[model samples]
Target: MTLSVLVTRATFADIAQRLHDHFDVDDNPDDALWDPDELKRRLQGKQGVMSHGSDRIDAALLDACPTLKAVCNVGVGYNNVDVEACTARGVLVTNTPDVLTETTADFGFALMMATARRIGESERFVRQGDWTKTGIFDMFAGSDVHGATLGILGMGRIGRAIARRGSLGFGMRVIYHNRSRLTAEAEAESGARYVDKSTLLREADHLVLVLPYSASSHHAIGAEELKRMKPTATLTNIARGGIVDDAALASALRAGTIAAAGLDVFEGEPRVHPALLGLSNVVLTPHIGSASIQTRRAMASLTVDNLIAALGAGPQAGQPPTPVNPEVLAARLR
Candidate 1:
């Protein structure tokens, strides 16, 4: 009997075809966003699921679907899935990691430059017909990216990629703070200096957050942290939402605590804070960090690969390419 699979969101036509070749596939061509109850209902007979960040795959949902054996995520971050809960029930979880590194880094750097140079606000000004001859000299003068201090909150793969752009391409001073320090060789490779969180906040002319989201990391940049930043500094978040307190960030931008901000992700997502929407100094974009066509295709293909492997349907049967909980697979083999 063929295994039943569900693609949780709309995906590339080719990707769906690949899954269809191997399994009894149920895909959302219309891309309707299903709430928890609806999601569980759709997941009833599914043995595998391709989950996105918006889907909440918890113990409750896991319990409801006893047939589920694999959860493949399209993005690098897996904070949305309850890995511990999935582990307890012997469900394998996997995410696409390396394929999106450079593309996401590219977007993060672009967002930072746009924020520092007031590109978003200036574009708005031009669109609104507010560009006049009288204010030519100082109308939209903004900060410089080259030779400025670039501070990163997380020095992971994406963070290191951003550091390379800042230090090598732009001649910026790169400093980073992570939960643990990188080795000396890694520091030299990335051109980043190790710094404490306080120094990172105080020194950075452009502070970019690339940290993961979790309970401890919830609102990592709140009111007090914002207070520590230089008034002329610009803040950028290419990381997940809820990493920065959107409310505190809006207040900071309003009071000139920081000169500007560029956010690709938000707290509630798809539904941004009203205060952030009204601000001229903040540049906002939908979460499209790894949005390049090639990269997105790679991510979707990898998800299908993991799902095919986990369900013993394809070339890598019993050996999924990337397993978040490999121990579960290990135990099964034993």
Candidate 2:
């Protein structure tokens, strides 16, 4: 009997064809966003699912999908899929990690550069014909990226990549704080120095957030942290939503507590805080950090591969490439 698969977003023609040959693949490639109830309703009887960031596979969703054997997430972050709930229910969880690491790091740098230099705001000023009235001393004078101090919140693979680009490529000083410090070799390689969170905020001219989202990490940068930052410094978050307190950041931006900010992910996401939208000091993207077409395809393909292997199919057949909750395999094997 063939395994059944449900995909949250339709990726490519070849992808659907490939899965069709192996399983009864129902591709929701139409790209319509489904509400929680609609998602739960469509997930019934599915053995595997190729999900992206939008779907939230929480305890309730896991309980509703008894037949679900595995969940493959396209993006590196699997916080949307509750690993604890999936493991408890004996459902495997996986994410596409290495393929998009470099691409995401690239975007993180881009957001940081844009935020510090006021790229978007300046472009809009030119587009609106405001440049004709202004001299070289125009309002949106931005900061420099080269020789700036870089503070990274998380020092995982993506964070390491960012540190490399900052320290080596841009000649910036790198400082980071994580749950555990990196090896001496890694520290030397990225030229990253470990520092307390407050010190990093105080010193970094450009601070970038690439940490994962969790209850404890929520609002890691709030009013107090923002207050600690230099008035001329810029902040950027390419990490998940809820890492920075939105209201506090908004207040800081309005009050010029920090120079500027770039945000790819926001608290409550898709629906941003109204105050943030009104601020010219901030640049925002719709969580498209890993959105290159080539990278996105790679992510989707890897996610499918993980799901196939975890569910005892595909070329690797029982060999999962990435495992967010490897403990689930123990219960499934029984």
Using TM-score as the measure, which candidate wins? 1
Candidate 1 lDDT over residue span 95-214, tens digit each? 999899999999999999999999999899889998765746777899999999999999999999999999999999999999999999999999999999999999999999999999
TM-score of 1: 0.99
lDDT of 2: 0.89
Give the Cα error of residue 271 in candidate 1, in Å: 1.2
Best by lDDT: 1
Error of 1 at 195 (Å): 0.5
lDDT of 2 by residue, 184-270 (tens): 999999889999888899999999998889889989999999999999999999999899999999999999999899999988888
TM-score of each: 0.99, 0.97
Report the poorest 10 consecutive residues by lDDT, candidate 2: 132-141
| Total clashes for model 2 | 1
